[model samples]
Target: MANENTDEGLKRVVGVSGLALSIVNGVIGSGIFVLPAIVGIAMGAFGVFGYIACSIILAAIMLCYAEIGSRVTTSGGSYAYVEAAFGNFFGFVINWLFTFGWGILGSAAVMNILADSLAILFPGFANPLIRGFLFFVLIGFMVLINILGTKQGIGLVKLITVIKLLPLLAIIIFGFSQVKTGNLHWEHAPSLKTFGDTALILFYAFAGFETSLGVSGEFKNPKRTVPLGICVGGIVVLIVYMLLQIVTQGVLGAEMATFKDAPLAAVAEKIVGPVGATILLITAAVSCFGSVSADVMATPRTLFAAANDGLFPKFLSKVHPKFATPYLAVLTYGTLIFIVSISGGFKQLAILASAAILLVYLAVILATIKLRMKKQDAGEKTFRIPGGLVFPFIGIAAIIWLLTSLSKWEILSTIIFIAIVCIIYLIMKKFQNKKPVETTLETIL
Candidate 1:
């Protein structure tokens, strides 16, 4: 057993800049690379409205997170906040929901995008065997970087984030000149259903910001960092997404639907020729890699936190003496992602991943309301949202509205998945001793 009184081996090294960049890396991922075409197909020149709608929804959710995260100040992000407000059962449920239901599945889907983008650049990647090998190498590489230390993991995220954005910024800057004014006009507004469905899919682009909050335990000063980082990072993401949508839609216009898989690359090819297409493809690969690396760096902390609270296997909580990281948790997470990615079943479940994340966000919003009513941090100087409960309610309504777009099967499957997670939690509790074992720092080294 580890010593509980000692501090966890994790170092508080990440600051606001790192956290903000992490949020950017998480939110602007593979979805943006392809979503332009999907939204453009659905809404034409008005497709940019989808980005605006999603930003509003995400803004509400991020406000709730900023408030609750300031008070909770722990790892596991949504899992930790909900557990503190509700109980261990709900916490356990959320941990699995966010970790496996959303994080792993979503990253696996993005891994497919990465592989496909790479295959465009290198034809050999088109082979199933080669793609599987690529998944193993990429996932293993991320695990190793994270296990070595959080700094290295974050450093790579920062580098790739910058690398991926350059090509995107270039398109936004140069492509607008080539956009025909005729392509920027729409005769009529899209119907509510059409708008809702497209916005629901675009929401996937903004879904992973919470994953960055999973490393609160390692944040240098979380109270200030959480709110500032989330809000600032969120604003940056909104701007980038909106501009990209405008440029992509403006450049490709109705023809965006022709290149469903790589809309941004098509836009690039139009603006700067074939060389531009090559750069955008490489950017897509790097952007996906950055998102997965950020996940590998942060999401494992949710597993580590859960295990320490006796909701997961104890081994996952063990901190490496030399590296001061949850090595086992990182390895486990990477392995799951690799399995799901190589098997290529995640695409079928992609909508389920979106639905699952909505549930997680709904839970967190409710947790914020509960925490506020209970005066959980009355004495502590924690960040509070400007509107008492208005934002939380907005977040709730937006999530519910978005969830309405799910098919009956996806909704039922989400319910089944939640029930299965709850059952597993109960079984673990039944076998646990009167006092659950808590893992802490084994040694400081």
Candidate 2:
């Protein structure tokens, strides 16, 4: 693959506000609208603690990325950092793994939106064929927006982010007033297993905060805004997740588990009747679209970076002839989403996304350690990590704990990807070490 991309990728016009909203756009997807019930299934009323714990763990990772982001201003985000620290082969492997996760996630979003939209539009119809067609139409529509222009695409993200936050705000404002202390108390002592399991689920909600970090190359002040966008975005997410959970538990109680599919709307219905639920449904649809948009916008940049660097096919590096977007990479990702949406069940795709993301978290934390150690050895310092070495250790330990705590699919994918990456690295290195012995001897003589 040759490096044929001529356009300097996406133009750098999105300001701090756009980047921050893009972070919110990427992070606050359908996860918050629905995961409370799933979390409640693991630990009942104690699920709020799991949300907070996942936030804390990711906060540490985010700070590490902030420090790491301070150092590198490339478009690839985590992939670029890992490549600088560990070189290109590992970079390609992690990039591939991250793409798998992003694809599954994007597909999950597309399908979720399709299923929800179908229910809204044709309530009694449970036709798979109908839903599948709508999924392509909607997903393709969002991808086409990106193919048009980055500025236009991110503008859409900002709009969706603002619109989607309204229902959540309404939930917090209206639902908290109807609190019941009884629901906050657990029926039994919560098990550590339950806690870990619940945290893994909510971690999915927190997964996409790195959206801003991945766009560093497109930032006007790449070094300064990247850290601010990432840290501020993370803090905002942590606050929202906590409040959303608190009010949800207060409003819904034991039924949180019952309405696990669309818990926020269920909570809203309890707060303000049928109209509230409808509003929340509209919010859910909009929020999920923002997430899908964020995924479509961000993921291709990494793929474009990989392609530009020869880690992926060169054609993927080419900008769209008309739009000047990474149209090939975007389409490739859209195709992956279409396949995953139609072929695999939603639950399966969700678990695979979790596993794929855990691999990325593991890689980033490991890269942070490498960068931090090198800084220490050189007697150089940069952004202060929130708790210094302690934070990184906690972050690494947290990801490991979550990896073990996740479902069987999450566990297997994490292990398998790591093993395969190592094998690939070894084979490549072996080939590099092999030389033409006769030619070498003759040259030396």
Candidate 3:
């Protein structure tokens, strides 16, 4: 156990397959099952084109993160990138928000799905007290999984990912036979006015691609595996998303767009029967669970990294003596998630989570540009993004474009989140700096 701890702390063990699984599990969640309806409402059939465009944009951003991860293989994702490129304070602030802001939001979204799934099984489970109890129970389950060990948590994610993808793949295949050509109406063309709105919705679907980078330090050959895994995993997800969307739209026409919940299940019911709808609901529940599992595994790593760097409370820095995990941070995150899940509805929390993640994406792109200029001799990055400076530049621009498309309320909420993070960063920094400096003269006695 001690040897394993040393090796993990020194960057080893994880390989290409682990990295790929992380990326796949992170991105392939309820978003694919749910976001199609949201996007369809915003852009009609043209939303399919918008999803394609956003995939391309996300691919570009993935390349930028690949470059940064290759240069500095570390845990904490955007926090490490920003710190290496700019300085400690800015990076700490970004890391703080990335951990707390999105962590609670993501947890709430996942718990909401769990609660809704319970409501499906028990018709009268919609009571606020019942829902709240289930949410806390789910959070407790995830926290326990994480506290057990990283490998245990990741193994569960791998299993859930396979289970979740099966129904989606089945839907794509079976729904193809039931496709109606008349359903696809291309009367509306993709335009600037609609593009931004659609892109913002699509961004939510592609939000978790960079999650692997948060634990790059765990990878055996991070420089080689991280880049390839991110690229390949993202491309695979893109293909799956596009095919699923195309088949679903063909099967259900525009009716799927108006569903308040379980849009994919509604489409499945139209094509097959009640059995197909039940299968899709199960798939959605599994996907949501898989996402929460990945979140439980990855988010605590960021907190552990920050605490180790003296950017958070010291207790969070302690590793479990037996399990070698960040037990305290995991518990704390789960607790916060349980509290938030009781108040916010699933859709609202989903939007809030996406909004918080977009800010982190903006920071990552900026970090990439800064690193390229600052470390000119950083050597050949394993997966150098095509088009030297243009890709990262365009990636940053794309994130900025999406940010502007969000509503005024979302923008205000994001700003307030950032302000809160900055305050926490300042307090931690002051505490760190105020610690007495021990000198050789004092130690010699």
Question: Global lDDT of each model?
Answer: 0.86, 0.74, 0.74
Q: lDDT tens digits, residues 146-178, model 3?
A: 787766766777788788888888788877898
Determine which window of 10 residues in candidate 2 has minimal summed lDDT: 1-10
Best by TM-score: 1
How do these models rank on TM-score, best leading?
1, 3, 2
Give each model's clash number.
Answer: 0, 0, 0
Those runs of model 1 whose alpha carbons end farther than 4 Å from true positions after fitting are 1-6, 348-351, 376-379, 434-445
- What CA RMSD would you report for each candidate? 4.9, 4.9, 3.3
Q: lDDT tens string, model 2, 13-47?
A: 55667778898878887667777677766777777
Model 2, residue 350: distance off in Å is 5.3
TM-score of each: 0.93, 0.84, 0.89
Query: Lowest summed-lDDT stretch of 10 residues in model 1?
Result: 436-445
lDDT at 100, model 3: 61
* Model 2 clashes, total count: 0
